[model samples]
Target: MAAQHFRVLARDPNTRARLGELHLAHGTVATPVFMPIATQGTVKMLTADDLEALGAQMLLANAYHLHLRPGETLIAQLGGLHRFMGWQRPILTDSGGFQVFSLSTLREVTDEGVRFRSHHDGTDHFLHPETSIRIQEALGSDIAMVFDDVVAYPCPREQAQAAMERSLRWAERCRKAHRRPDQLLFAITHGGVYADLRRWCTERLVAMDFPGYAIGGLSVGEPKEQMFGMVALSTELLPDDKPRYLMGVGTPADIARAVALGVDMFDCVLPTRLGRTGTAFTAQGRLNLRNARYATALEPLDPTCDCVTCRRYSRAYLRHLFKAGEATGPRLLTYHNLHFYLRLMDRLRAAIVAGTVHQIVDEMTRLFPDEPSEREA
Candidate 1:
């Protein structure tokens, strides 16, 4: 059977924020959801049970990384990605277009596809839209993103336009090439920071009428204001009935603001990556466990958090674990960080249903006053 459809349940009176559901082949996901990145079939140090316990409704994986490492054919023979990863919940597989552009040191882009060397072993690989669709089909993910041409931020308008046109053509190829009846394919909108280009791309994709749409090409070192503006514009042009995803974005603040702008889904590496480096996302903000001030501070990571790490461990102990180079430190922090992000999404969803989205947005903005540097996060 094909993946189920998206259902918008309630909309905020004040903002575009809405409470909805994305019915997938694996399960139904609550909207305004935050999908933890399991780029290589795992969320870093966490397990599937850990993800379920953290209230994760879905997960995001990469076709690029998985295709290179274990290869999709091997995974398909072993019962697809869900059984391979032990994650029975819904999974969204990215086409690796971003990875091909970002990770490959050597690449050539043609109207048909991208030819590049794998960053892992410098192995030669050619990825076209059809190849991406085929890989995701073999992986058997619940949702698949179309392969897109990603341009760097601050690119010339001409460059951005050319990439945008190419991405549109590629999206059509993905649409035609996709063969998995049980998986939903989502198209991505790209245009750098150019409004006209973004609108043009969105309009054309909407006309194609995929199951969902994702706003990509932002959050690549562009200013926060510019990114938000692009999100607003894209969401404004997208159909209200279909789910809208904001790709590779962002902090708690970024999620809240984007939700207000009508986004329904998000994914990022900040939580897991930061957690590994001794940082924890708290209700009060980010707390670095490596700081000396926490050397003797005996409080929980967050006074309000109920995660096992926060409930059973104190700041002092966590700090010690990191200082002592214990692997458990990163594991604990990763768990807590994912819990925080997932809980934040829960709060936002409830707020949308209760007509209190603005209040939650204000609170999140106050807690995360400034967006952390992407590299630092």
Candidate 2:
């Protein structure tokens, strides 16, 4: 049913990279795309108009956060998340499994569901796989991820196997419970860095025949090589006709590498989060605007960036804004960082069409030479 919503148009000769399109209820989105995190229905310090201006194809929002705050019923009453957020493009709502699991000290996971205390008010709550599906359906996102059991990196083999099996069971529950025909439910594969477990999970999930698949339980403090290895295995096992999403992944280099491995969709909070902390992503590397060296620099944030922030504002002015604690400083940096990411996807897609995806990967590898840090990866 949901398979009719996506199609691959082109593929890279050298890699698994492909050019594709997601035909969603709201709008169409291109493959190898990076979705900006709009966790609370809005990207911090940015508006729907701003996101549109920045050329963001789709936004990633959290069902857990929105379910806790404002509630899903209210959003549905307000004409769903699209009208509620004033963004008419495609939106993907995470199953909230990660957020629930992140409260490790305050939560307990069982085959039935997860029982947890909200970080906001210490309130008690339970999220079943069925419950996650209902919440996402009420929110009315174009793509809804299945609720999965997420385990930390370096987890014991036995524990990883148990969690992976539980995630597959939950995926089955979500598939049966999802009722929104307009919204596509995606399955998430969880194997915690074990090649065999990853393959097992991927094979089983692919059999479920979801419209799309997301490689989850990664980018959670694992070594880059291990993460990529798992991703490679998962993507290889997943069906080529379906889109593969790498959840909560990555930097520019990470995106490039994942794209090469056959990932089609990605979402991360790095750009906005780093921007708020006075950091800017540039071709050369991350630039700390708080540094004294930038206080006298007159060039733009990234000389190659055509974003409004980079086109009009000088590095000295941006540093001054940050140093002076002006709110506009973070907004500008966030805009440009988003621009950089979206632009990177655009370039990759073009390369895929041009049969030169490796050129973009080479450029990204050169710009981001260091190994991915746990905090950012």
The digit string of per-residue lDDT tens for model 2 on 1-377 reads 75678899999999889999889999999898999998889999999999998889899999999999999999999999999999999999998998887853467999999998888888899999999999999999999999999888779999999999999999999999999999999999988989998998889988889999999999888888888899888888988889999988888988988898899999888889999989999988889999999889999999988999999999999999998999999999999999999999999999887888888888888888754532221
Write model 1 residue lDDT over 225-315, tens digit each, in one string: 9999999999999988899999988899999999999999999889999999999999999899999999998899999999999999999
Each model's RMSD to truth, in Å?
Answer: 1.7, 1.4
How does candidate 2 fare on TM-score?
Answer: 0.97
- The per-model lDDT (C-alpha) reads 0.92, 0.90
Residue pairs in candidate 2 whose N, alpha carbon or C atoms collide under 3 angstroms: none
lDDT of prediction 2: 0.90
After superposition, candidate 1 runs with Cα above 4 Å error: 1-4, 372-377
Instruction: Compute the lDDT of residue 237 as modeled in candidate 1.
Output: 99
